[model samples]
Target: MTETTIRKPIRKAVFPVAGLGTRFLPATKAIPKEMLPIIDRPLIQYAVDEAREAGIEQLIFVTGRGKTAIVEHFDTAFELEATMSSRGKDLSILAPTRIQPGNLVTVRQQVPMGLGHAIWCARAIVGNEPFAIFLPDELMIGSPGCMKQMVEAYNEVGGNLISVLEVPEEEVSSYGVIKPGAKVSGSLTEVVGLVEKPKREEAPSNLIISGRYILQPEVMRTLEGQEKGAGGEIQLTDAMAKMIGNQAFHAVTFAGRRYDCGSKSGFVEATLELALERSDMAADVRAAIKRLAATFD
Candidate 1:
């Protein structure tokens, strides 16, 4: 008789792109905010790229009404690609948008629910294994990428791991602050509890939860019974907080840069910053920046 061990290779990642991006206003009225491009690529593309680099095989999208653009973006543009190839255009640029038909999946949320609700809606597809959740609005650009870093940390910790970052104490109230426990060396912090948007003085720690998360299937069950929190919506933090002691919950301070693409100012800044890094756009972007700065000076 041969003994078998369960292999917990993180494979599936869920993207909650269903929310009404009201912050972006008229623009988001038609196109999903996830489709908003940072430079040449869309916000969701950066997130998808990060997930794929972390060895995630299936991309599960939790979409809402009027978000068909997201579905079309991931699907093949056979006619467009064929035309591009015939016109001597490079087809390799379209590689990131290509997800094998079998590898991509989407489930409609059907409502403007909370993040927990959005994640819970995908329960049928997530099954009984550990999975990941990414908020496309939070764009993290780095060498190893945010999710890749979390996936590597997850392989060692084997439980719920959220990518966190340090923010000014005053800004802690705007985020789900982590109630940190024992220092587990390096960037790993044992998560003793969670506080969803606590007052500045009431916050446990300055380390706030960013978008990237590696969660267990049990969370779906927890979310099933979760009530409304901060904004009267089923909060994912509430469900995650419940699993703290029962599961190995920890936080990894992401080694990268994160941009809040959900906001107009942050969106503009990210576009300019990322564009300035590209060789083809750097010179023009820099020149434009100087011209804009001269107006201020």
Candidate 2:
């Protein structure tokens, strides 16, 4: 690892979960969207597990009102556990839900300003280290997790790193597109510049920013200006763009399937796909689906 990489070992990760999740309403009206289970595990659990696998010591959650369920999700359910144990039932089911003490930290974003503002709210807790950001709505299914791959590249590049996923050229305008400058490694590239939701013809490349990001502390300082962008709100991409050319900037092209869990369709698809991979539920899920398909036939 380079000297810079050693100094900023990336011990903290910020999860931007304050969004109102209007797309998934009215289920989200009372429960947080992150608390919605993909199958058995909630969406936030997958994100936290990924961060923990990447050596992230602190999971900093940027949340809002009605999001207490998110915080409680990671806490010890003492009464429930005690009841389960008293019945002589196996307790391994609650294993993954348990979070170690001191590993989780949460801060409230009073208002829904924007992604940048929500992240900026964590500046104090994050202090001066280069922290990571993970959007729980995007479930990245990979062997080592997306953030771990980015950390490997971040260690070598020693600057800001964002995960890039190849989308159809027609979908370029849906995400922040990157202008590939040079190849850094196998799937890593030197990102000289980027454009937010550019038209197909204006897109720098087919690559679009994914949900994972390893950013320097300076990005928060840049967001302090609170300059509103496309949606009349401070966009994180705009602030991140300013960091280009200031240091080493690159994008790590992902080698995993990303399930967009923010929308109903995507969430259902993820549930079905993941359910098919389990031993206990695979047969039943597939048989039920096949029966349902026969009805259409």
Candidate 3:
């Protein structure tokens, strides 16, 4: 098995947590949707965890007005920690929430722009180096985590790479589908083209671009003068499409389950599925699920 050559170590990662998260309202009315927990940890935490696992050093959060909670989640809760310490309760539980000093960075996206604009907001912080992007709403579940797998692949290939997963043909219209070039390996495919939310028949393939991406800094230049393509928003897909031929773009077919927590159904499914996987909660969650199903019957 080949190992990561570390051509350029991925140091920074951007988390676009600026969206209003209207789908999960009024719950999200007061709280950021990224703060909504899957079981114990918030969605953004999972993304950060993945980044940390992948050896990312800097965590950049592109945030909005109401998203302060997202940043606070990673900070040290002194009062809570003191209370826990005084009570002699297990303090290690807070370990996952704690980020190392000077590692966490925040940049604001004042308007509710598209994902591309949110990402571009962090370009100054990202400098000239390559960075990873993580959409917190997409709860990717895997043993090594999604970003770790992508980092390993990125270390090997050292170009642009987006995590792709084959969704159903009927669902192709809902996602940015990739026009595949060649199957480089079982899990790697050269991305010749990208069609954002293409009609099912017009879709190049069933593979949809998932939430994770490792992009070159040149993309920032492409997005600098980029006009809105779809929905009058600066779409990342449009910028990435322009970089296809100029750069080596590929897709890493995700070998994990992705829970689209952006939608109501997906949120509930993620909560229940993750809960059931927990040893402490599984039995009770299973019984509760059976009881809930009985009401419908």
Candidate 4:
């Protein structure tokens, strides 16, 4: 089949969890950064739930030496389940943690390379099928979830797709901005080119690449020879840029709230906002927030 051929469905997703999270040093020393919690569920759990909602059957994780906790999080805990069952406690909460046999796969990224290198590590399992990619630290909150929205769009246009959201002009340099082409639809744009962390004056558009992606397997082939780009590491943006005209490349504008849980402020905001939405904690959280605000005043 050719590069643009519609052969297999997008049945798999890759989560790059091998990063040494130096930003959250002390906390992430022992725990994988993806295991950091937002409310009751870990950040990786949120990404997995989003992937499942999008009908993704296989979950592929690119891990590192100290990231075994991530694999354990999705495995069935017999002792914990039995304890809860015998104590007459609710077992429904543990349902999301269980994965069926062979549905989950983990590959180690031996070195701490760029995001492109990390994704390339999972090339074997992804095979020739189109797959989704989720940066677990990005906590996306939406009605149907971010990946579901991308999958719905991917169904209509079956090629490489990336999620984009408009950032302020000054903040454009902090992200990979797209050189947009013709407007495909309401929230879809034809991506003609991609620039990684361009200066504000040189930016093509304020629309920055977000964390969720549904990429064609051809991307893996391009990454095989991908040289270091902006960060002196194998940059995914550079590889994606090369595939712009070869395939049907497009960007889905995510209509949702995205918390960059990789950052401290963003993580705190996500915790408060999600907690405030919960019925069990809303009243207390709001009251505590009011008291905190008074203290600041």
Candidate 5:
């Protein structure tokens, strides 16, 4: 067999966790939405863990007000660790969760402009490096994690690789839809064009862009112009669309389950599914679910 070489260009990752989770109301009033718990771990933790798994060396978080709790969550809590150690609790449980030293950096978004603006805020820190951007609100559950899969695809293609999934026609209006080009491989499609929040009939394709992306740094220049697109917000997709023919852009259909934790129904579903997957809560959770289902029956 010929040797198959994979090139990994993107090492740093930018996570935009500055969104005001007004949808969650009182719960998110004092807490950042990224800090909301999915099951035992916070939503942002899953995004961080995914980035680390993809061999990302540096983690850049673009945050805003009321997001200090997110910074503290990843930082070393010496007292808490010491207490857990003294209690003879399994430290390994916390090992995979903690952010490795010196690898994390946070930059303030300052303004709630948009996803594009949030990403642009990290331009100085990102410098000239091609990096990954992950939205923690889209909680992905799988053996290899969503972004890791995208990284694997990125190594093969060496250009912008986005995570995409097919949504129902009715749901096309809720996402940035792609105009797909020639097929490259299984679950990998060449991106011809991109449209943000297009109506069902106007959608170029059924494929919807998810939260994971391995983007080239030049896109930063596009956002630097700060031209507003949909909803009068700087749109990353609009910037990315400009890079289409100039660069190699493709979409990877991630092999995993994605939960939109930003929505009420999605959050509840993720919570219940994740809770049921936990050994500590699985049994009781299944029983509770069965009882609840019986009530509906």
Candidate 6:
């Protein structure tokens, strides 16, 4: 039998930024959660940057109320650009961050449904193309972005790819766990099953699902009639599970540091660790850490 070639290119990426960041509280009251700064750049910027690095041409944002700021952030601000240019400052730094004209699109999700619903909001834009979905809250840092790694895996396997990371058994319940199948290659596994937030004892594997996803267009049809799963929300994983028999599903164990920016403590840890890696901040952070440790002693 001849092998079938995957025709669609993963050009478009969907970002579900409509959530009311209740966890962040008062800070998120006016500011959209995606705008919350991880270090100097907003959380959404990192996700967008990751997508662009992964060769995504169109950035589709599924937004809601108070999310206009996110749209504006990616757009060029004439006043700011002019001011910086006049001051002889490096303007190129802002250029890559700005989404190229006509490449960025925003669709509003009126109701706070769920991840699945947010993804479905972009159905019109995604059309029949195999696209990517990124969660800004899952901050992945590496030489090549997590999605790019998954894209490479997709090219090899020619199927739907989800980024998975091996977590301790105790932490498996905190994330969606994937059941292992045949080992396809190094860091790539054929996914037989997926369990969302399963208890440690019931977890099929230690490989917990992270944010990066390269999905087939057919999954949208599954979401169209899919009911809510897990926390009474329309979970994307539920729809993905439906595609098991019909589609080729693979889990790519991403080689990167994933920080769950959705949680307060995780965000702080990411900030500190990322900051420590910077040449400018390394010495200062190290000195401060040493001082703090000495105080505890």
Task: List model 4 lDDT by residue over 1-297, tens digit each.
Answer: 653454567899999999988899999999999999998999999999999999999999999989999999999889999999999999999899988999999999998779999999999999989999999888999978999999988888888899999989999989989999976688899999998789999999999999999999999999999998766889888898899999999999999999999999999999999999999999999999999999999
lDDT of candidates 1 onward, in order? 0.90, 0.90, 0.90, 0.92, 0.88, 0.90
lDDT tens digits by residue: candidate 3, 1-297: 333444667999999999998988899998999999888888888898899999999999999988889888889999999999999899998898898899999999998769899989999999999999999888899978888888888877888999999989999999999999965787889999999888988999999988999999999999898998778899899999999989889899988999999999999999999898899989999999899899998
RMSD of each: 1.9, 1.5, 2.1, 1.9, 2.4, 1.5
Report how far off residue 247 is in candidate 1 (Å): 0.5
Off by over 4 Å in 6: 1-6
Q: List, residue by residue over 165-246, the lDDT tens digit for candidate 6.
A: 9888899888899998977689899999999889999999999889989999998999999998767889899999989868
**What is the Cα-based TM-score of model 3?**
0.97
Tell me which of candidates 4 and 6 scores higher on lDDT.
4
For each candidate in turn, the TM-score is 0.96, 0.96, 0.97, 0.97, 0.94, 0.96
For candidate 5, lDDT tens digit of each residue in 1-297? 322354447789999989899999989999888888887789988888888888888999998888999989877788988999999987787776677788889999887888999999999989888899999999988778888888778777788889999888899998888999977699799999999888888999989999899998998998999689778889898899999999999999988899999999999999998888789989999999899999999
Off by over 4 Å in 3: 1-6
TM-score of 2: 0.96
lDDT of 4 at 161: 93
Which ten residues in a row are the worst by lDDT in model 6? 1-10
User: Candidate 3: global Cα-lDDT?
Assistant: 0.90
- Score residue 239 of candidate 5 by CA lDDT: 90
